[model samples]
Target chain A: MIDLVSDPWPLVYVGITLGVTALLAYVAKLLIWGMMRQSNPQITIAAQRLGVSIVWLVGGVVAVQELGVSIDVLLLVIGLLGVATIVALRQPLENFGAKYFADVYTPFKLGDTVRVGEHEGRVIEINAMSTVLLSKGDALVSLPNSAFLRQPVVNLTPQAWKEVVVPITLPGTMDLAAFENTMHRAIARMRVRLDRRYPPIFTVKSRTAQSTDLLLTVMVRRPEDRDPVLAEVNLRLTEAMEKAPASASRAASGASAVDPGH
Target chain B: MHSVDSRWGHDAGTAAEPREEDRDLFSDPEAATLATTAVPAEGRMNAVSVLINTQTPLLQFPRAPRGRHAMWEVESNFSRLVEGEDYRFSPGGVSRMVYPLARRMLTEGVWSDVHWVSLNSHGPEMVRLPGGITLHNVTIQPEHLGGYGKAKEAIWSTVHGLNSPRSSRDLFWTDDYGEYTYYNRVTAELIRELDLAHDFDLFYIHDFQQLPIGQMLGTIKPKLFRWHIPFDSRKIPAQWRPLISTYLNSYDVVVVSSERYRGALRRFGHRGPVRRMYPCIDPAEYKRAGPDDIGAVTTKFGIGPNDTVVLVVARMDPAKAQDRVIGAVARLLPRFPRLRLVLVGNGSFTSASSGLGIPKSRTWRRHLEETAASRGVHDRVVFTGHVSQSELESLYERCAFTVLPSVREGFGLVVVESWLYHKPTVVSVRAGIADLVTDGENGLLFDPDRPRALDRQMLRLLRDSGPLSRKLGEAGHQTARLCTLDAAVRDEVRLSGELGEN
Candidate 1:
């Protein structure tokens, strides 16, 4: 008891804390995947925030023991470092975050002509750094994604007001044919507002072993209803992904009864 | 002489002059010497590798196998079952015209190996027929089957001038359009896969149903598209021009059945190489039935010798305009009491249960029956659903003359069939065969829409006695020679060589 201050129990506590933090971080990843099985973007973002916070918390404790300092001093130093980092990378980080949100919320996409601030041109490319637009005179103009958050942006292409683009990511194991059929049937249910001449087009942008990126374009009758339509489209896509396998199984079984000419 | 030769040479250099016809013909000394030095080989061991595609398959088994045996296993060897028992030749233009060309090409050594790809839902995956010909079947799901059917029907109706532009406006944007694209894509994929294995020298695609296939294939190989239907630019909608032109331009050459169709294709803005090759059948296949064959067919149909038969051999579809023929017969029944109108053929492969399963043919046939009944000529008209080739040949021989009353025809091959049998035919002016017909010369032409045009033509043929009928039938026979398999094979081979060059 007299030498309690000099005992190694505090270091042991820090080690225990770090171990728990590491374990929690791994568990949180699994939980995030399970909870976001339907691919809810908010759940993914929140899970990522929790994971980073846990990493920093564990690092703080480890730093305190190595410096021969108290946990309190380490936390103060860490907080200052985080504040300095945030301050230094504020604009870029904000733009990056805005781009993430814009991917899900923005009505216009690459190849779409849009007016943001004083710039109006066809979007040639959308990169993590910025969105580049090509003017009629063939001049390239780059705009930071964060500008979309602060300024009033308007899509200028004719009938672009009616366009709503949805970005979707699907697992590689999922059958594309089945998914396409299910998505078509699901989208057909919302045929009232959609222009019949331009039925929803689902284009595969990129694909990999783990996942595939797809763009779904639909033309709406009214310009003001874009937001609500997007939410519905996203919900329908998730529901379709869930319901497609069963329908595909039925089709496969039915096709088996009759020869598929294979 | 030297001064004169020099002056001549100088004059040739200074003068812009017209060349003599014989000189142009023998302009190249090497070619002229080769032509003169060598007796042109009358025949050679020539081998042609061809890829053939049509909406209709060459062979459709009458029934799907009872058990779990695969079609591939069944079709590869026809020895497992009898020919007439297991499968019957699919009748109509495909079996009549296209099959004979392929078969004759193989037999005559014009083509060595033939790969025929077609839409076959209930066929074996692959069939190896006689004469080293292989059949590749393209299959689609039943759910998409309906969509494909609707899309093709829309296209057919639009092209035939049956549907209004407003009704067919959304044809390219629906889910059915996707299925249509899927079917074409599936066919293209099959062709590409076969090309990978066989490396065909030429590709010949037939009919409007497969119009997009040439474009979808996107291959560097020679692609030839045969627009087997009438291609009237006036009938086409403004919205569809771009897409149709785009597809048509994909082919290295476009072949139509008649000069009129060729002109129509040009009007449709197809700047590609276009040729008019008459659709033909093997004249040798039309077996000359003796008295016994005719008696058997007449007995089977329960028609007496005194009955004046006005035969129409067409599929039971509304577009064939059987009702117009019936109306003409109804009007003639009062003048000639012994007239019997015989309508041949039933539903197509599309209407059959084992195929795409569209019921348009049944519905259209029912409507025709109702029209005959309403017109009070039900007993006078015979609805012979489907007949064998022997029965058909007998019917053609027994009839005084035939009438092709289609509102719009691809090319009245049946008229050519009648001509093959040496029977006079009254053809619709709307038919592609109208290009070949001179009124009252080889065959008669009548406007299908005009009130008494068909009746007038029927009366003209029926009232004629010895010389007129004989003269018309003989003239028609001469025209039939131009569209015979022998002529078609030569043209096809020549066209194939030309297409292969570039």
Candidate 2:
């Protein structure tokens, strides 16, 4: 702590440096969010975290230097702490990292009857570290998320291959009806490649005061058309978001091709 | 001499005097029946708020004048407006059936707060009628309405067996379907907003146009759907089965117009309780006009005193099969020299300029006129489009018999109306009301598809006009009791109570 009775120049400089660091961190988050708006929401969020951390790290060193503290020692201490924490929490960190990748690549979701390796059951819950399933014998089985990446999983749902679920995060202040209408009009143009029997539908997953989570599902006419249809749908959805009012915070995740479970 | 009522948001003492006709419009019809009917006492229910939705609005307003904008954004009170000039009550099941049932239920305290939402593009955003019922209007963009109308009309035609299933099998994937979903989504969002404010206990959705609403609502509250159109499981396209079944299963209970439809719903894979409630009307809404009233309407239609009039009351639509009746009448003209056919009603809400603006009604009417002309009976056939309530009563009083020639009718309520007038009716075998008609007892049934079946049935009434007609008419009047407001109120109250318990 700086003594207030002495010269106040150093203290003012330290306060100014910290305040500017906070402003820069917010700007960095918005910039990263804008740059990766079309990418997976997880990657955008992670990038934002990295950008904020860098800004704070550099500004923190400059602020500490104004207080007559050495910056080298602090950097060395933080680097060692980060390394030790990663080593100690290796299992959980691995599971956590696997959860992110599995979320992007996994074909099965909750309520789906899936067979992973030697286990066959219905998915009941998916957490950060593990996936819970209920067996046919009414037994609950917990499997680490990392194991999903290592095993081959088979989805047993009928016509599950036709499902393409696109997750969207819309600002609460934005009009849901208008957005849905716009997206519907956009998706309708691609009906030639979609299943003629199952129209595109939007299902609300959850909502908060700040944002609403929605899943848009469209069925593909041919099994081979799933990948291209999803990519086109994501592109159209991104264009729709860009055209919307700037007041809305746009965040649409990568398409998750899975059984929507009707 | 004025009373203080806060419901109208006006000082009654200084308010404009309501017209005499307005008083007659607001007169409670249930009070006359409540004395004899077995309605539950007041406060039987827990005063739950209910939400009602339909595609047809309760009232149809006239178009705004040129260079003048209508104040549709403001809330309107029906009591302060004139009937014909300001707004006219829509003429269909909404006006003749749903409105009276809602008013009667409110009178009996079965429902406390009722909010009705409908698709009214030109009407006010909100309107307050008497008896605690509020109407909310939902409008879609003009550009989108065409696609929505096309999709709904296709479903209507498919269900009525007028079109091949293969023709519209891929309707769900068309861009028009997206517009249909847009309309439903907008309505659902508005309903959700209302639900958040009122905490509705139940949602009652009506007819096929709103079939997807139950699935879109995303509410925990119980939903009841009433299908007003003919439902034949075999007529539904295979491609529509999954979506239709999903929508049906979303509702807690599905109510159909007849037991036949209820069975068909079950066959369609609906995993929910189904109720068979007959389409009803208020007997009090009709009156037996005197000689002068009958003579005035007859002269207006150029009916001679010696002519024996046969009436067919249906909107101008192909499914109604007005041409079938015209052909039958042409054949009957040789046997009965004084035979005259009077076709009543013009169009439904869907065909109105203020509504979907579909030209089906106009095209069907022109086709009907051509058919009559080709049969060389244009001089004998009279098309009196959309008669008033009293005029319809006068026509009912003057007619010798009525015919329901629909190719496929959900439930022929016009037969019930004719029965109320104690007039003999020849109903089609395809109608749901045929189940209620015993052969040679209450009414006569004819297969519309059979070439001369309707002509033979009509000859039975024309040959022996005294005793046989009287016997059939008297027994038919008794059958009408099963489909009146009193009977409907009891079933509806029980349904509401059941939903409350669950």
Which candidate wins on lDDT? Answer: 2
TM-score of chain A of 2: 0.73
Expressed as tens digits, the lDDT of each residue in B128-209 for candidate 1 is 6655667766777788789988889888888888898777876766788767766776676567657656777788899888
lDDT of 1 at B250: 83
- Residue lDDT tens for model 2, B1-502: 0111321234453267644322321135554554246367533547667889998888777764333344444456566566666667777655457877887777777778788888887876667776688887777778878988998999899999898999989887776877787778778767766776677888999999998889888777899999989999999999888779878888999999888898898888787999988888876566567788788998899999999999999999999999998999999899888999999998888798878999999999999999999999999999999888778888988999999999998899999889988899999988988889986899999998899999999999999849988988999988987888778887887787777677
Q: Please give the distance, in angstroms, between residue B366's alpha carbon in candidate 1 and its true position after superposition.
A: 2.7
lDDT of 2 at B423: 90
Q: Candidate 1, residues A1-262: lDDT per residue as tens digits?
A: 1233677676676677677777777777767655654444443545667775777567666745644666676578879999999999999999898887788677688878999988989999988768899988899999999888888989888888887777777765565556665666667677677666566655566656576577777877787677666666766776666665532221122322222332
**Candidate 2 chain B: worst-modelled 10 consecutive residues by lDDT:** B1-10
* DockQ comparisons of all candidates to the true complex: 0.10, 0.23
* True contacts recovered per prediction: 0.06, 0.29
Q: Which is the leading candidate under TM-score?
A: 2
